[model samples]
Target: MLSPSSDSPADDVIRALADVADLVVVPHTRLADLTTLRIGGRPRALVECRAAEAVTAAVGALDAAGVPVLVLGGGSNLVVAGGDLDLVVVAVRNREIDYRTVEAGGAEAGGAEAGDGDTGPGGIVVRAGAGLTWDELVADTVARGYGGLECLSGIPGSVGATPVQNVGAYGVEVAQVLHRVRWFDRATGTDEWVSPGALGLAYRTSVLKNADRAVVLEVEFRLDAAGRSEPIRYAELAGRLGVTPGERTDPAVVRRTVLELRRGKGMVLDDDDEDTWSAGSFFTNPVVREGDLPTVRSRVADRLGVEQAEQMPAFPAAAGGVKLSAGWLIERAGFSKGHPSSSSPARLSTKHTLALTNRGSATADDVIALAREVRDGVRQAFGVELHPEPVWVGCSI
Candidate 1:
């Protein structure tokens, strides 16, 4: 007979899940090894799923037993608490990619012929496994001479997480080209493919965020096959590429420039660089209502001179609000790049004002303390709240 110790709740679930091919389960895994922050504690269990069926089977069994599941991807956009976590981590590892150009009359999901493909009036399509690194897909597409993802080239995370946050940068968002998303609906235990419209995508957010309503299995993006990039919208990118505002430049040029800019900002992941040991762009730029822009501008004018206020960076939000720079608010609020000091365990990235980084020995608490300090400080100075972009686990800001 088996020992009673051999059949605990997690073990029972794992045993039942073993029948699913390509799904592996291990107990007592540290989340610090799984997140970009490098500060989380160990989870009760870790499930590695290499295929969609394995993911569904493993998660379904865990959910049925009322086990808390934390779906982990590339771990680029997460912060988890340091200590014994009470949940199980589901790490997606499938990595498959297929390319298709839209054929005449808009073929069905599997209608297009498979090849290196091109973009044009009909558009190119890329289908990738949920576990694929986002930048890898972008690099592949651009290398093949595609252009739609140029502005978003250096972003870190999984393909599946893109639509969850409607990931955007340099004025380009995943929502603009997402065609289909295959998800395992947690609430219903159903797996299926749905159109992008079903996710209710918006600026840096979607239905999958915080709700834990579903687990994305794969993603499909439509791309420009004409070998020209989307219109250059971000001024900094345009200037670096030597293109006029709104001009369509080569995707390769845009990708290179964006990577350079991100590296300088410590937004790109660099294992050897402590400044990049962070969740890129810690705060999303705050968007104030249309009527509220003047109040903010006036505040800036009052604090710094009228000339400074006139030059403050502000843009019309896609949803009509006025988007103010979070970095600007942080700096004006007295938090400079590498705020606190180089000796502190948690400090602002010296390369960028927006990133809150871990200086090798930071506990989750250390990072949180800095985040709260920056956030509360910014609110007091500018009356604008800074919202964190990374997903927080077992902690709140």
Candidate 2:
């Protein structure tokens, strides 16, 4: 049983996969080439699987051979250590999409249309292969007058990564639109489609997150066919679209606004912009106990005065917890945007305090050092912990 892991000495596996018409094995590619952060080490081998069967076969063979595998999607939400990583990269490239309009009273999508404006029930269902770029999906839906994904516009990464993180922005989460997911279970080596309930979807996390238990093959999202966006919820996004809270607007309008807002913050990827050379937001908003909010509020009021504290972004969370903005906390903790200096290789994005960027020559060590500094600084100032939002490989905070 040969695997493609060169370091594992999988020459036999490489030879075996050469006969696989659906799997293309590209040797000697670095993780840096595949990831957004532009930092990472070389993998043992890079295997591109363009179909479900190819993916199933590649992963199964590698897993059975006792070789560690890193499944690469858009590589937008990952941070890998520099140097030679002792693992194989199984990159999923199977991209196919099917769209259907679900007529009124003839569809089931985990309550997606239940509270979607007042457009009366009917919606659209898009079944997209996991490898499709997330923003591309959003753009297509908006172009076709379909809604539900507009709020998530400008988010980097692939469709498969969405359900894994329940990726959200502008008050819309993938959990809200996600209806079903087709996955390859590693344990049983079987393919199956499961509902959202089975995924344990939550804020920026899901059952697949950090589990390495299953591979998402495809995803199905329920959208509003009436071309209306999901009810405007996030205040900032609502204001930009000129819609009151809970009011739905044109999907195109929402998409354009979201992209503009993202660009302003350097959240959208731009090859010429170093500020965009980041893994999006560095940390998730810290969700804390409700009873603990006042203490943190006082910390804010103490440093920035009462007026600023009152305006600090604080939202309700599950179990009466309060979600505090990580960006607000970082800036308040003395880590200003572009902290220290702009000449440094690894610095916070000038446009957004939340993004820790690579100024062209930063290494894994530089990123880790800066991330630790920000995380520790916030904890020391507010006594609240900041958890990283990206998946770290061969590194830890």
Candidate 2 lDDT over residue span 162-214, tens digit each: 99899999899988888788899998998988888889988899989988899
- lDDT assessment of candidate 2: 0.86
TM-scores, all models, native as reference? 0.94, 0.94
lDDT digits (tens) for residues 156-175 of candidate 1 = 88888888888999979888
What lDDT, from 0 to 1, does candidate 1 have?
0.84
> Which number leads on lDDT?
2
- Model 2 earns a TM-score of 0.94
Q: In candidate 1, what residue range of length 10 has the lowest lDDT sum?
A: 112-121
How far is 330's C-alpha from truth in model 2 (Å)? Answer: 0.5
What's the true lDDT of residue 186 in model 2?
A: 90
lDDT of each: 0.84, 0.86
After best superposition, candidate 1 residue 210: deviation in angstroms? Answer: 1.1
